[model samples]
Target: MSMNVSEFVWKRLQEWGLHRVYGYPGDGVGGLDVALEKAQGSDGSGMEYVQVRHEEMAAFMASAHAKFAGGVGLCYATSGPGAIHLLNGLYDAKMDNQPVVAIVGQQARTALGAHYQQEVDLVSLFKDVASDYVAIGTVPSQVRHMVDRAVRIAQNKRSVTCIILPNDLQLMAYEDPPLVHGTTHTGVGFPAESKLPEQEGLQAAANVLNEGKKIAILVGAGCLHATDEVIAVADKLGAGIAKALLGKAAVPDDLPYVTGGLGLLGTKPSWDLMQDCDTLLMVGTSFPYSEFLPKPGTARGVQIDIKGDKLSLRYPTEVNLLGDSAVTLKALLPLLEQKTDTSWRNTIKSNVEDWWKVLEERAMHSAEPINPQRVFWELSPRLPENCIVTADSGSVANWYGRDLKFRRGMMGSLSGSLASLGAATPYAVAAKMAYPERVVIGTIGDGAMQMNGMNVMITISKYWKQWSNPHLIIMVLNNRDLNQVTWEERVQLGEGKTESTQSIPDFPYAKYAELIGLKGIFCNDPDKVGAAWDEALGADRPVILEFYTDPNVPPLPPHITLKDAKNFMTMIPDEPELGSVLKNSAKELLSTVLPGR
Candidate 1:
């Protein structure tokens, strides 16, 4: 049986367990779209064909879906501008190590050398960002090989794979139709028999554990496969635990041993706790923030990681043990003696509680009209226990990171400094698609929400009707201005920079949400904010709660010191001695107004 090249490609996608295909249709790839439609009818597998507004959103959705579901996500785009827009999201997926595959349509094979319409060298454009790139010029020789290679690359490296298909190649017929097999799970097995740790390494780890009075455990996403084992080690060592943001849900945050995260947006207590520890154990996490790490001269460190390169990358390690975290911990457990005194653990736990209490008190007493802390307090309680919250980079993220508490089963994703707008909405869509049963929420700034919120609503209306009732709650902090930019401007200009002068367009977000088939509410009153949140969460369909907030309000970043305060004071000009007085007054106000300063 012979078939067109596009049909064979579609059949292969079906065999790879791709039920949903995300992309925008273009003239160059019209045949492939038709082939997908035909293939759906043949297989009796009603695959979803989702048409997105932008190729970037499509790629983001694919990446998020892959990350949430632990599988391959598929997306498509036309050549030139369409394919170019996908680079940002592709880079994000590559950095985060998610499995995604992008199929891009190219200009005709005949026009390869000539500069034709929508023509660019996509292979070169994606070479650095993607794990593998395959250009399918011939039917039998290239199509199957490329498809097989893409699947393998995505699965093995957990990275993006690009398949470039020319218009002419898609229309050509193959002499032999590609044989498709059902998707089968190639199980991920641990070492057949765990390798016992080297005696030298075990002895070194045992010595550190036995001698150290105060120890801290820093866990990362590398422990996703062995959460229980890592937890056991933390328990055995009686050590305080802190996680990287990527490892947010690695363990339940409510556990007494769990302190918090460490980063620019991380908690201050986590940083203080790390500093106080005499011995720091890096287990399964490669935390990127070098500034928050303990000073090499003061704290002795030990690292247990599968990747040897990450052992001493951030901090100097006295003992670098190269093995799986669970395996290494099990080996060292027997050699360790339990301590009778847990004064260090008790002290750290008390400090963490005090820090949290201070944070909560400030959020409650703050007088700012558009308080971000207040918004987080209201929304955090309304969210489901198993909610999957995705945050976009902005003031809202800073607020949420500090105030929003993750329940035992809740999961969240934040793209650490790749901090692009429009990520939250698409990420919510993908997460909802991946885990239909879990409630998916997006915490976005007004600017970020307006970027891709409508497109995600359309995606939900199109694909998610049959699987489960789509419950998407978008909490938009509508401060009407880019608060981050405003802060930077304030820092540059002495004191009274006219923030109202900034060109921030205020749109009718609630009306816009209704226009896009989502239930919408606008809450201006602070008291009504909680009611609005509750209503949105209880609703069955997609809902957007746009809360109008004070534009002059500020959300404090994680970890600011007295030196940082002095820096702010020094940055201001000494024109009116009153400016210095006002700076001091503002500092005093923040100390009293904000929590956990």
Candidate 2:
């Protein structure tokens, strides 16, 4: 049987080791759908087509698939609106530096310039996000090279790429490039190699670290595979480590010297570590918030990164070592002289110990109905071993960042730089698909849950039974407000929460889960949060665990500066939930000074 261009595209993706493609059905992609159907009927060439409720979710799942599975994630969408819907998620992948390739459908080639229905200039639309590469398939011969280039570039650059397939061309028989001028041939696979810095550069970085009295190390997603190397370097320097939000899983929080997350959703220990350190060694992190880092001219900096562009961009480095995280660290280890003074390490440990206690006090702090922090506080110890965690952008992320302590072997991520809402559920779905035997959990705010998270529950309902481990849990913090933004307005803009803009309608999240043939558990009582988690985790199928949480409980930053203090104080007089806000704010502040009381 002669292979159509559409069939050839799928086969080419499979050759590059992609077994799953997340997408939705539309007439713009009808030819591709027919090819997919044929492939599905065949014995071994079939790809798992995860039909998502929205194209945006498909893109997000692809991003998550790349993040969790460590490969080029594949997603497809039909013309115009469907292609447009993928932008937000693709931006998430781009900002976080994950590899993802989008296969976009276009209207018939003949009608492109006629302004026919669904005729979109996809190449123009994708050029910014997929800035590394974006190409259109005008000929059957172009399909092979397009797929090859898209997959290879996405993986090599660790960024987004797009291949636009016209519906008319997709149905034509695929043809190999001819032995003639103007023809191009491309191959599958990017070779594996380890990059290491020069010995002189490694020694310079080591000397800077050895001379410092108090050193702080920052790691991001780049250190995910370099955990042991990071630990070794930190131990050698007697340094404390801070993890970027996207690099939460780079090192387990159980380490005494690991100071949780950094920046706005960061911990007090991390803030102190940065403030007090005389030298900074940033490994594989481009943590965006410079205000949260050591002030300029205060700390001497040294940075290691695979990308030279990312090196020293956040901090002014005395030495910049360009190499892969683990490889460079391994070579640099022999040059580092072990620190004899344990005072700096001891101070960090003390601060970290006090910080955890402060979190517990805040989590246990009483609220109007349920403290949102307590919900996550209760979940920390209950997390299943080796589970993959996902959180959407909202107040939920604050707790996910601050409270949940991830152990070694666990995996997690979110929309880091983009921080888009409605991403958690789809990310969890992709994680579960990638590792069927592992548990997965997604924490989302009520606003995000209603936006598109609920629709993804339908996607889960469609596929949960196929997973070997059916322990996927979606936890909704039902606070009835655009909680994170409301707090941001208060803290950043010194403005009161505008009722029309900040408030969201209440929905029965748990009930909706039940309606879709999944387990649903609803809890309003703060005391039973743990029991609710237990019930959901032990359920026979996937579960939606909804908690009626207090919206007034502030997601406070680690160390509130005077500017933020003034802004927060300015908003208090006109705040809608004034009393609850005052009470919770007092408790949260007191937690820092009155730990273990």
lDDT of each: 0.73, 0.92
Error of 2 at 329 (Å): 0.8
Tens digit per residue, CA lDDT, model 2, 380-432: 99988999999999989999999999999999999999999989999999999
Model 2 TM-score, all chains together? 0.98
**Collision pairs in model 1:** none
Lowest-sum lDDT 10-residue window in model 2:
37-46
Misplaced by over 4 Å in model 2 are: 41-45
Residue 597 error, candidate 2, Å: 2.9
* Pairs in clash, predicted candidate 2: none
lDDT of 2 at 450: 91
How well does each candidate superpose onto the true structure, as a TM-score?
Answer: 0.87, 0.98
lDDT tens per residue, model 1, 1-597: 778888887877777777777788887787788887876676556566767878898888888877677678888888788889888777778777677888888888889879888898888888887845555554454676677668667766667898988888888885443345632223122124333569898899889877888888888765655567777777777788888776776777667667777776677668877888888888877788887888887788888876566788889988998887777877788788777678888887886776667566545543334456677878777768788988888777766676777766677876653667778888888888778888888888877766776667677666656547577787888877776655545444434434455436787877777887778888877777788888888876787878887544544445656765665565456323344335433643565445455
The number of residue pairs in model 2 that clash at the backbone is: 0
